[model samples]
Target: MTEQRPTLADVARVAGVSRAAASRAINGTYGASEAVRRRVREVAAELGFEPHAVARALATGRGSAGRRERIEILIVDPDPEAMSAKPFYGRVLNGAMRALGDQDIALEVRRVSALPVDDTDPPFGRVLINVPGAAGAAYARRGRTVALGRSAPGVAFVAPDNDDGGRQAAVHLVATGRRRVGAVFGPATPCANERKAGFLRVMSGAGRAVASADGDFTRARAYMATRELLEREPDLDAVFASCDVTAMGVLRALRETGRRVADDVAVVGFDGSALAEAADLSSVYMPVEDEAESAIRCLLDPARPAPARLPTRLAVRGSS
Candidate 1:
């Protein structure tokens, strides 16, 4: 005979808490203290208790005969090839899937060239990426929306500490005795700007001047920008690429100009992606997967506040 699966009642009884309290704790709703919530969750885990989706929906007053809860990931990138080409998108999807493990929620991904997303059918929740904070905030009016980076007060967000990552890079370069520094700067987005600001702050304090060129977070643009920066600063001994993809372009330019990496010209990149690992490049490692997971958790339970910002650290490799 098959043993019956553990139920919420079993969890509540074992935890020495009321069933109502157990439900609130499991659902991340109000009325449950932190200690109670933790204890209930631990008890539930021990018993292998899994909540029934239909029951949960009925309890929350969101259930219908044939309807299941759905969450959408809205990406605001003009490029049609972003989903396949960008590693960041893949990482985000992986994290979201991890957070939604064994749940009955439906996941949908949609890419729009620009926003105000005009979808008439709003999902139960939404995750916004590559959208401005003010623009992303507008979606909160329609449904529960979580932004991937810093957003306006009305919207919740999960962001990396971009400023701190940049500061770390600057210190690393300076400590290595690099004086003539050049930079490939990302486009004027909030996260990119914060990184630039932090890097500049440390550079100014160290009495170093940075020669910079603009990059649009693309390999082609970064390649052209690297060439342009090299032309303007021929004696540059080190460079900081805004991201790992951009670092590939910087490496190519250096090779073409007969500059030895790490020996003659040190190079540092961001994102700590597979590209960086394969190339043995130094980079700032941000918890992209964790950020995505946190965003999904916020969507699952509106009561939970989205994490303000995740942490970042420098990973020193052969390129630097």
Candidate 2:
């Protein structure tokens, strides 16, 4: 087992002092004398018990008067390197860095996948980068972390108006008078579920029926599922693919089945990735950089009031 926790007794015994003395020294309380504090520091160093600087700083009010600097933009993605490589990743980072760049604060992108938190020093302050599932756990290590996602309360994470984006897609299909609508959805991501539910809501609201709905979060998986959906509804008039990658799959499948995009089966995608732009796919777009900025604000001023949802917009193109 790889554990990083340090016991108070370990620090006290090594210092040749009592636990009360060691605690007072670390806590910067009046309980310990100057000599006791000195011995406690020496023992802590020898035993490798890193002072919980963040926790200590809060209790002691040390360095609290300085400007709020260095916003920790923790990236919770499983693949840290790949996240750095992503075009959307760069855009979001640039957004965050640019915002803090003016304020002289740094944007710290930490991957929960690569370097796990050092419980040894426990962060002084934490702000969610994005993708709450991982950030939630990673920051939980520090104990004063905010969530930066849709519906993450008492913390900071931008919620994309996925439901509204979905409604826009459904309205596009309905306005075109497409009776048999089809869809390709990703698996249970917060953003994904919001977009899916939005589509269903709009369709149901308009008294239209969904010909087919498939759950897959990957490009390949969505491609296969879209192919099956097309087969299930040869007369399928419109389709909503949750993410841009998944939308690309849906478009490919529709073409393979001899359905013309917009002409035969209209299409729309979510997140607005590179493939969506390169292929010129019409889409409902969410500003990831704006989301990043919101995270920074929450970290800097907890009372700054986070957005309930980052506003979403639709970009109409050849697809829909």
Candidate 3:
């Protein structure tokens, strides 16, 4: 007698979950928590349940004859030229590529000036970079979108502990005996705001006041902002740059102004990019590649909730 092939129902029965939940878990979609997904997969493996490819394709709205499954990475950057100058995005792409190893999925990269309003042909999933938290919610109506940083409620995202990173920067500067501190703040994005807030909170707690200037997350802007900050607070003993690129600008500004780094004014930057290591600048290191990998995994197996915040630490260098 031919042995009947194990079914999803059998797996669900063993896992003690509803048929719908079992299907969701197996298909790696939302509505199934990590625990549920794990149990379902384990049961499926024990029961030797194999999902029919055609049925899966149909369920996911990708028919066998349909276009290949693809994940689109939408970069919301106004200045296209900035893409080449930024190392952070390169790291993100590298991590995404790593996470996609041997997966039957294609990746598409696109730079957009603004979020699209049209509900055009959406890809299988989307990875949003440098987008504001408010604008992220709109993508929920489009398709499965996983943002790289903090996003509005109900939007799936993966991000580092920017606030904690900022706090670490403040603590380091203070412990290093820097009294008068200045900050080059990034653009008014959710992640940037969080970083700034955390820094400010620590400084305030220590009874220290920080003078700040706005930078557009660019070297040029940060250079100008740092110069302006110096003009406002000539006795600035330490500066916190929002990112490594911005830190480069701050360093350049300090050098051009006859201010010696680590001796005259200690500097600490965020992002912990290669730029920081090359310059030997003290920085708060955030695992950007790991965050990117988590984001990719979330898009692939959306059944599990993404991690709210990844760990961050301070990498002390000569700059501080």
TM-score of each: 0.80, 0.68, 0.83
Return the TM-score for candidate 3, rounded to 2 decimals: 0.83
Q: Global lDDT for candidate 1?
A: 0.86
Q: Give the best candidate by TM-score.
A: 3
For residue 157, what is the lDDT in candidate 1? Answer: 84
Model 1 agreement with the true structure over 1-320: per-residue lDDT tens digits: 99999999999999998897788788875346678889999999999999999767664435687565678998887777777756788899999999988777788998888885366888878999878877887888777899988767888888999999999999999999999999998877877888888898999999999999988677778889889988998999999988888898899999999999999999998888888899999999888899999999888766677676788999999988
Tens digits of per-residue lDDT for model 3, 1-320: 99999988898899999987788789885446789989999999988899999767765545757756788888988876766888888898889989888666778888888877775788878888887767777876677899998778989989999999999999988888889999999998878898999999999999899999998888999999999999999999999999999999999999999999989999999999899999999999999899988888888766667986999999999998
Worst 10 residues of 1 by lDDT: 59-68
lDDT of 2 by residue, 60-151 (tens): 44456753334465555554354634455676676667556554344566667544545564443465544456546655555556555553
Which residue window of length 10 is worst by lDDT in model 2?
147-156
Q: Please list the residue runs of candidate 1 whose C-alpha ends up more than 4 Å from where it truly belongs after superposition.
A: 1-67
If ranked by lDDT, best first, what sequence of candidates would result?
3, 1, 2
Model 3 gets an lDDT of: 0.88
